[model samples]
Target chain A: MRILEYIALMAVPAVVLFAGVVMLFGGKNYFESFIKGAKEGFATAVGLLPTLVALLAAISMLRASGAIEFISSVLKEPLSALGIPSEIIPLLLTRPFSGSASSALFSDLIGNIGPDSFASLCAAVIMGSSDTVVYIISIYFSSVNIKKTRYAFPLAFVVMLFCIFFSCFICRIWFK
Target chain B: MLGKIFGIICIVSVFFGIACGNTGQLGSAVIDGASSAVTLTLALLGMMCLWSGILNVLKEAGAIKKLTVLMTPILKFFFPDAYKSGVGSEEIAANVAANLLGVGNAATPLALSAMKKLQLQNPTPEIASRDMITLAVLNTSSVSLIPSTVITLLRSSGSENPFDIIIPIWITSFTCAAMALILCRALGSATRVRTIRSKDYKSLKTQARQ
Candidate 1:
């Protein structure tokens, strides 16, 4: 299983390289297109800067103030019973509604706690696996003028529940 | 909603930091976080530039169109009405392929067009048809082949091998997507029966249109 993960790790770069090679051989004006796309990517990255900074500052202050530890201890009993590390409680609570905010929390965790730590690893998986249900629904539905979502929110919420539980369960075993 | 949480968290943390007599460290942590965010942004800029550039090359090579063609069978199975609606299937396929590559910024417009096309074919224009709902659900839970954002974060944070989480992330995301579809299909039968038995959904849809 670990070996498979190792291959998966390597495959990301391998696949990207292969894609580039294929395109280079099979396409036209490749350099111009690449430069254009690179510029757009850089611009988008620049746009994410402020939101990331503000949210991470708040999260870091909270962590240093021992607010997270305090809250974790308060919920420690119940969370441990479910095999959830208390450190990730913040992530679970915040992730469903707002994506960037949760990601801010995630980066904070990886920075404060080493990335290989159990809590950090689990946070990474949970953040990666889950969707920002409320955010996406609000944006997509409103764009299309979908006022009555009927079962959309409820069903998506159910999937989120599964995501939280299963991601915790799997991370515990995968990285344990 | 996020603003409220942010305000609440900051106020609570700073107040507690003062009480804990760690105000100085808390201030420093905030600064560190800011610096860290800059570092992360720089790293992300590099990765996104490379991937988006490669994606541009692939797009130019018509690989994405080929991918759309490859996606037709599954797209058809999920939303046959799209194929029937002339251009709807194409838009849906483009949206899904972009999503698979984790280019969500590129997928939204494609989705809006697909949704519009699907809407055009709706017998009852006010209510969302099953195909529209499926397309929306699939788009939201879209299975990403490479989670570039998460990877960039991990790499910036100094993980020995940032991409080790790839397999796990892939499995979990794909499972969620599969579960989403299964739930949609199962409820579809239930929804059909409910539509005839109750006017609540119909009224709701009419209200939305109004």
Candidate 2:
């Protein structure tokens, strides 16, 4: 199973590269177009620099200050009353805002709890299933300089909660 | 909006760290986090440049047009405003294709391009159109044929079967997207059922300029 996963990982880039070569043969101004696109990409990365700094700094501060841990513990009791495990709360909260942070936390959870455990599996599901909502909204909306996001922010968050609920609920049923 | 939220969170965290007697740790974390953000941005730059370059080859060859044709109907339904803008749908098609592959980095450039195109048609230049909101919804709750990142993490953790979560993630992705779409349709002013025609959009574009 792991072998197949590794193969798929290796294959995506290969396929893309192959397609890229095909395009070079079939297209006009290949190198010029690539440079043009690369220039655009470079600009985008530079443009997102400020937004990334702010979001990551805030996240790091919260993580370091123990606020996330504090909040998770506080939410645990109330969540348990509703049949949700407190162990997965941090992962749920972190999953939507930053991918690297969530990935770190997820690997940590699997290490502490054991991989075969239901909690670990649930963590995997939630992490895989949701995008970093706040990051996406902040970067994309700000990139186009659209100050009025209208329903985008609230709608993304609402969808995020639903992903968490369904990830845990379905994990419970499937792993049980 | 996010700036304000991040501000409140950071200030609260600063006070909380002081209260928790971890002022030194918090200070270091902030610096470390800021540096890592730069590192991540650098990493993004590499991937973005590579994919954008490669995809540009395909794009210049007009290969994306085939995908655009295939995706036109579905994209047209979800992004009516984008379709009205004509060229915006091309970007939308590329964005959606990258998204379904679970390559968020690859998708970001396309998504941003699509957003800019959609913004051009927006009645209010500063506000997102219906299509913009839907694109965000789609990107956030995107379906993936292979969630390579998640699987890699689980592998590092020594999961007996990391791939086991595939079906569950698929189910979760579908539901998240479905619910997001329904919510956007129900709660968004975008869904007031006001179909903004291209003629009206053009006139509004002029008005917006004025």
Candidate 3:
């Protein structure tokens, strides 16, 4: 476990070091290439601002209007019956759409139920395994200007549910 | 697609807000949400730019090319059409490699570039091609070698062993990625088969008329 943590900590710096060494020996101005890419990244982020605002606004509206909470409460009984811990239900509900919101729910869950509990493990696994489906779909498709996403949204949603379930199932078995 | 979903969300939320009599909260959420989005973007800008810069250097140094070559066989399985045309395979490979390292900020720009390249090869400009959908699904069910952020959060929350969940995360992520690939391949072929059957039906009708 300690070794795994060490490797995880080193991965980023190792990649940067490798890039630096290669750039140095390759006889090109690394700063120039970096600045060029950084400029593109800045432009990309700026371009995505409107999309983020639109998506986040709708999500926040859902939260503020008590829609997500209502849905979560309704599902609590059924999901808990299926062996899912109630503590992680809110996290699962928000995770497919919003990263930050889910993170907040996750920490709150750990705080409420203790960090070493089964539900917290499940939340951690879910966090590590899945990406924000709606956010990724909207950003990626809009970036390419594709209006007709065909089956992507439905398919991604289905996959997100599967991942959530799988996360809970694995954590249940492995943590025990 | 996003339009319909966004519309539904807005309408449903507004109605719910009215029913719950939290119009004031909803109004505040409207403003707060927009500001939060801007704040989040600004917060991410530095990290995104830094990784993009590093990736640029890697690309120029030919390191990305090596990763592309190594990734081609596996990527080819998931993206046969793109591989056959040789359109956006390199960018796709780079994107997947960055994602495997759990460097999402670096992966996003590569993914956007790959999408552009794939768009050029798309027969229908407004519709997502099979390769494009596959790429998006791949991103959603991303396979990561190390999920550092999750571990950090767990550690900060005072877990006895924050890394204990690593293996479970690995298993879950790999299973999701495999399932995503299978689903996309199945869905892609199902649509293609339907189109072909319809085409055949039209051809038969034309033959009979002639």
Top candidate (DockQ): 1
How high is the lDDT of residue A4 in model 1?
85
Residue pairs clashing, model 3: none
Candidates in order: C-alpha RMSD to true structure: 3.3, 6.9, 5.7
Q: Which residue pairs clash within candidate 2? A: none
Those runs of model 2 whose alpha carbons end farther than 4 Å from true positions after fitting are A1-70, B1-70, B188-210
User: Which stretches in model 3 have alpha-carbon errors above 4 Å?
Assistant: A1-74, B1-64, B193-210
Worst 10 residues of 2 chain A by lDDT: A3-12
Q: Write candidate 3's Cα lDDT for A102-169 as tens digits.
A: 65556545755787998889889889889889889889999989998988999988888888888889
Residue-level lDDT for A56 in candidate 3: 66
Ranking by DockQ: 1, 3, 2
All candidates in order of TM-score, best leading:
1, 3, 2
lDDT of 2 at A42: 77
Give the better candidate number (2 or 3) by lDDT: 3
Candidate 1: residue B168 Cα off by (Å): 0.9
Candidate 3 whole-model C-alpha lDDT, 0 to 1: 0.78
Q: Candidate 2's residue-wise lDDT over A107-173, tens digit each?
A: 5567567877877887877877788888888888888888878778888988887777788898887
